[model samples]
Target: MRYSDCGGLLKISFLGKPRIEFNQQDITKEFGSKAIALLCLLMINRNGYCNREKILAYLWPNSNDKSAKYNLRFNLWTIKKNVGLDGNGNEFLCVDRERCSINKDYEYQCDIALIKDLLDDNIDDLEDLETMRHFFNGELLEGYYFKECNEFNEVIIYERNLFEVAKVKLLLRLAKQYENRGDLDSCLNTLEETVKFAPYDEDIVLKIMEIYELQDKNSLAVIYYNTYKNRLVNLLGTQPSKKLTAKFYELSKRPSKGVKLGKTDFDTNNKQRICIKTKCINGIKYFWMASVIKSLLEVEGLQLEDYLTDTQLRDLSYIQPDIANSLGETSARTEVPDVRIAVAFVKLIEKISDSIRLKIIILAENEMDDFSRSLYEYLQDMRLHVDLISE
Candidate 1:
C-alpha cells in the first residue's frame, strides 16, 4: 500500500515478503528480529537523521564495539538486499560515515503522512482524506509500546483520532443525502456507523429516531426517543424539544402509516418469503447464489435452503408479493434467473416484472479466478447480469 506527505512519500509492498522501499531505493527488510528493530528506529525518525551512535545506543544500550557494528551492518546489508536501488543507484537507508536520513526524494504514504495534510486542509488534496482512513489499523505499532517509542506512538494516535473525526463527518454528509432520497435503509446504516464514532451527538440520535419512524418501527423509535428525552432531562435539566414530544405523541396514537404494510404474506411469520424458487441448489451457481439472496432480501421467515436444488443452475423462482412490495416492488412472477460471478459473492438479481427487483446474495470467495472471469465474460456476452462484491 502507498501513502504520502509533504516532505516525501512512504511506500510499502508485500509480495513474497514484506519490505519498505523508501524514495532513495533505501530498503528495510524482515531478515531477522534485530533487523526489524533497526527498521523501527528509522521509521520513528522518518523526518530527520539519526546518528550511528544514537541508533546503536537505542538498540543495544550496554555493548559498544565491532560486534555491535557487525550486527548492525549485517541487518543493514539485508535491508539493502531486500529493497532495490534508487534512480542514482543509491540505497534509501544509508549512512555516510556518521549521519543518515530516510531519503525524502521518494514519496511517503504512511497513515501519519496524511494526518498533517488533513489539518492543513490543503484543498488541492482534500480527496486524500478518505485514503487517510484506511491506513489506521490501531494505535501506531500497537505491540511496540516501549517508552522509547512513546513519543512516536503519541503522534500516530493523535493522527488516527483526527482521521476518525473526519470519517464521522463524511458519514453524516452521506447519511443526509440518503435521507433526502428516502432511502431509509442506507441512511440508517450510515448514521449507525456514525454513532460509533460520535455517540454523544444528539443530532445524530434524533436522526436515527426519525429514520425508525419513517420505517414504521415505532417500538425501536420509542426506545431511542425515550433515551433522548431522558438524556436531555438528566444532563441538561430540560425535556425533549416540543417538536420531538409532539412527534412521539403523534406516532404513538395510531398505527404507523408504514409503506407496504400488508404487502408480504410472511409479515407475521418473522420469516417472509421474499422470493419463491421452484427448487434449491439445483447447480453450483444456484448453491452459491443462495448466500447472496439471504443477505440482500431479508424476510423474517424467508430462507434460500428451502428452494435450492441439486442442479448447478436452474430455470425459475417465485417471491411473496408482500416481501417484494417492501423492496419497492408491486407484484411477483416466475422468470429466468439472473446470475453474476462477483469477486467474492455470487449475485442473482431478477426482475419480478418491469418495476420489481429480486436480489439473491451468495457467498463464494474468489469466484473471479482467471478462468472464471473468461467464463463470466462469456456469460455477460449472453446478457447475463452478474456482478462482483468482494466483501
Candidate 2:
C-alpha cells in the first residue's frame, strides 16, 4: 500500500495502466497474460490467500480442471520467478499446495494514487498536489481487460467505483488548494479538468465561472454557460437551474434582456415571447431550431405526446423534418421549406402555451441561420414577446 521510500520494492502502478517494476527496472514484459491476470487477482485481494480452484476458474476457465490446475501452477511459477526480490533478498510470493499469497513483509507498492492520498489526507502535501494537478493520465488499468474473465472484471468494476470517488475528491481538493493560493490559472486548469468528468455538477460549474469572473474573462464565461445549458437540455431533458441562469446574466452583464419568469405573462396577446439570444448555431433546414423546440417540450407541463404523432414524439429532440428529413419530398417541393411548416411550429407553441406557460431563449441571433431568423421574425409578428439578448 505504501510506495514511498521502500527499498524492498515490488513497485506496481495500477493507475492508467497496470505495470510492474523491480529494483527500479521494468519487469512487466517478462510476465505473460495469464501470469499478469493471476498476479492482479492476488494484488486486488491485498496479499490474501487465493484458493487454487478459484485462481484456476478465473485464469483458465475454459480449460478442464486438470489442465486449469496445471496452468495455474505454470503462472504461479512465472509470477514467482519474475516479481524479483526485496532489499533483504526475500521472496515476494508464498505458495503452498492449496493456496498462494504475497509476503506481507515485502514492500508491495501499487499506484492507486488518488485512493491512497485521499485515505491518508495527503492532498495538502505540496509535492503530491503538484503531481496530481495534471494527474488525469487515464482511469485505473486503462485499456487493460480480460475478455474471457468476467469475475475478475466484476471486481474491477467495484474497485473502479472506489477509484472514481477518490479521484473526484482529489481534484476538488487540488482545485481548492490552487484557488486558496490565488493561483487562478492553475485553479482554472484544474477546475476545467474536473468539469470534463463532472459536467452535471452545478457547484463545480459555479466555481469555474467564479474564477473566470475574477480574472475578468466574461466572454469565456458566457460561452461556457451557454454550452452547459445546451448540454443539460440535450442530455438531461432539462435546462440549467435559475441560479445558473441568473449567474449567466450576472457574469454576462445581459440582465436587461432577461425577463424574470415569475413576472412574465403567458397571454394570448403574446408580448415579448420570442426570447432571441444573440450568441452561440446547424441542419433540418435550420437544425438548431429543433433544439429550441426540444427546450420548449422539456418544460414540466408540456405533453409532447398530446401534440405530436408517436413517431414524432419519440424522435422529437433529435429528428426535425423541418430541417433535416427528406422522406416526404415530392416533385412539387419548394426551393425552400413551405411556410406551412413554420405555421405548424407556431400553432404547436400556441397549443403548448394554452396548456402550460412557457418561455423560450433562442441563442445567437447574429450567428443564427437565415431560415431560423425568419422564424423568429414570424414569431414576433404573431405578437409573441421577444426578449432579445446579444453582444
Candidate 3:
C-alpha cells in the first residue's frame, strides 16, 4: 500500500527486512523485489531518466537467448500491473519507444530522504523523529538476493548503510528524549535495544555502558562490554580501540558484586581464514565466501551454540553472525556459504574463550565500510588482550 507523503511526513525503514509502514502504523505489507528495486532506483535517480535499458540491465542482466527483450517487457508489465498504473495510463511507468522514467509530476516523497533531512536538521522533537521512524519497517527489499541482480545489490547496500546511520542517529535522539522525560529506564532500554541491532556500534554501546555504570548497573555494563568485545573480534579480525579497552579494563578492576560470566578476553593467535566460491552463468557471476576468526581470548572449554542468519546487507553483501561473537560473510558471490569455514571458526573460538564469540558471514566481495571496519578492529583488540591473560 502507498501512503501519500505530499507534505504530512514520510518515515523510511531499511533495516532487518524491507517494508514501508505509514506514519504511526506498525502494519506493513511486503513488497516484491522487482517493485522495491524499481522504487529504489527511481528514488535514487528521482530527477533523472531511467529507461528500459537501465531496468533490464539491473533486473535481467544474464538472459540473452533472444527472449531477453520479452522477459524485460514481461517484468516491466508485471511491475506496472502490480502498481495499478497501466490501466489508467497514469504515467507512473512511462515508456516512450526507447526511453522510460518515473512520472516526475506526481507528488512523491521518499521516506529515506525525509528521515535524513529531519536528522540533519537536528530536530529536537521526539515525536517528529518517531513520526519519521514510523515509515520504516525493514531493509530495502531484504532477503531478495540474486546473483544476476547487481543493480539491486548495489542500490540496496547503499540504502542499508544509510538506514544504519539513521538507526544510530535515532537512538541518540530517543535516548535524549527519554532522558528529558525523566524516564531513565526507558532511555537505558532504548540504548540497550539499539546495541542488539548494532552490536558492532561501540559508540552507542559505550554510551549505554556509561549510562549503566553511572546508574550503578556495573554488571550490565560488564555484560554489554563482554558481548560487544566478542562480536567485534569474530566479525572483523581485529580488536577494540585503546579507549574502549581502557574503559573495560577500568571497570574490571573496580570492585563488583556481579557474577563473573567467564574469561573476559580471547586469543588472536590464529589468522582469519577465508574461502570464496564463485560461479559464472550467462556472463553473470554468483559469488559466496566465508571468513572465520577468533571470538574471545580468556575462557576455557566454553562453547556457544551456533546462531547464524542474514541480518544486514551492505555494499552488495549480507552479514551473518554466529550468536553474538563471531561473524560470517556471505554474498551473491555464491548462493551458499562455505559451511566448512563457518564450522571451523565456531569450533576454534568456542574452545578458546568464555567471552562472547561471533562468527560472521558476509555476501559482498569488498571490505566493509569505515564504520564497520573500526568496530571489527576494536573487537579484535579486545580478544587479543583477553588471550594474553594467564587465567
Candidate 4:
C-alpha cells in the first residue's frame, strides 16, 4: 500500500530520530526513549508477532523476568495510550500476554516500512524513487541507543545497511532517468547527492566522471577524482582501480614540457610541443583570442587522433575498440578542438558524393553551429548545387 496518514492513524518515523505523529500532532516527546525503541521493534516485526520472551531479552536482557515483564507492560501501555486508535476505531497495536505486534490491518504510515515496500524490487517510477530519497534524512533511529540490547543494535546495523543500499539503488535509478531525459544537470546533481552516502562506491564515482567528461568539464572531473582518490587513501588505505585511474589520466592530460616553437606541433611520444601561447598564431597577432584559436586549429596537415571513451563507444559495440592498434597500427590521443576530425569527415563526405548525388538538408539554418556553417561554406566552394527553403 502507498504510505500515507490520510486517516490520521498512528504514523511512526523510524529512519531518523524516532518520531510519532498521531492525528497530525507531535506526540514523540510524550514517549520515553524505551517506548520509541519498543515501537521501532514492533514495526520491524510488523509482519508477524514478536515472541514476548524474545522482546524481553532484546530490550531488558539484564532484568529478571518479573521486572522485564513489568517494563514491557509499561512501555506497551505508553504506546497504546498515545497511539490510541485509527479512524475506524481499530487499535493499532496487537498486544497479548504471549506476544506483541503492530496490527497489520492498521491504517498508518511508517517511514522505514515505506522504504521496505518501495524497495521491495527495482523502482522505475521517478516519483517513487524521489519520495524514497526524502526519508533518509539520517540513519535508522539516529537518536536512540539501547545499551542493554547488543542484539537489537546489531539488528539496527543490519537494517541500516539494507536501507542504505536501497537508497543508493533508487538514487542511481533516478540519475539514469534524468540522464535518459537529457537533463544532464539534474542527473549530475542526483549523483552528487548520493556521494555523501556511498563515497566508496567506485561505480558511482565512475558515473560522475563520465558525466563530467560528457559535459566537457574536465577540470571538475579531475577535482572530483583527486578528492575521491585522496578520500580512499586516507580512509580505506587503498587506491582506485586501474579503470578509474585511467579515467583520471585521460581527464588530467596536459602538455608535457617540450619545444615551444611558434607552431602547433604535438608529439607526445617524443615529448615535443609547439604553441603560440599568446593571442597570436605563427607570429601573426590577432585582436581576439577566438581568431587565434580558429587559426591554430586550421593549420595545414593538422591531423588529430580523437579516441572515444568507453561510454561514448558503449552504443557502438560493433566498432571493436583499438582495432587498428590490435592489428599493429599506431593510434594516438588528441586534446580538445578536434577540428581535424571534422575536416576529414567533410572531406570523406565530398569524396563519397563524387560517385553518388548527395543532397544535404539542414534544419533550423538560423541555429546552425560553427562546424556545420564551415562545412556548408566549404561545400559552396566546391560548386555543389544548394537550395534554401524557408517559410
**Candidate 1 lDDT over residue span 1-391, tens digit each:** 2233243323652211334546545454445655655665576566788888766666655555787677767877876666555545545675677865666664444444444445446332323534554444444344443345444445546644765786676667667767777889988988877887885676787788789878876545554565556556656787776677777665555442332311222223112222322212322443333333434345432222222221212222232233344444455435533441231222223221111222222234445334334443444464433333333
lDDT of 3 by residue, 75-131 (tens): 567545544422223545566667666666543355665666677788767777666
After TM-score superposition, the amount by which residue 21's alpha carbon in candidate 4 deviates from its true location, in angstroms, is 0.7
Instruction: Specify the highest-lDDT model's number.
Output: 4
Cα lDDT of model 1 overall? 0.50
Using lDDT as the measure, what is the rank order of every candidate, best first? 4, 2, 3, 1
Worst 10 residues of 3 by lDDT: 271-280
Residue 292 in candidate 2, Cα distance off native in Å: 26
TM-score of 1: 0.42
Location of the lowest summed lDDT over 10 successive residues in candidate 1: 351-360
Off by over 4 Å in 3: 1-36, 64-95, 108-124, 230-239, 249-391
User: Lowest summed-lDDT stretch of 10 residues in model 4?
Assistant: 280-289
Q: Give the CA lDDT, 0 to 100, for residue 73 in model 3.
A: 65
lDDT accuracy of residue 207 in candidate 4: 95
TM-score ranking of the models: 4, 2, 3, 1
lDDT of 2 by residue, 124-177 (tens): 654565655444456766787777878877877887777676667778888888
CA lDDT of every candidate: 0.50, 0.63, 0.52, 0.65
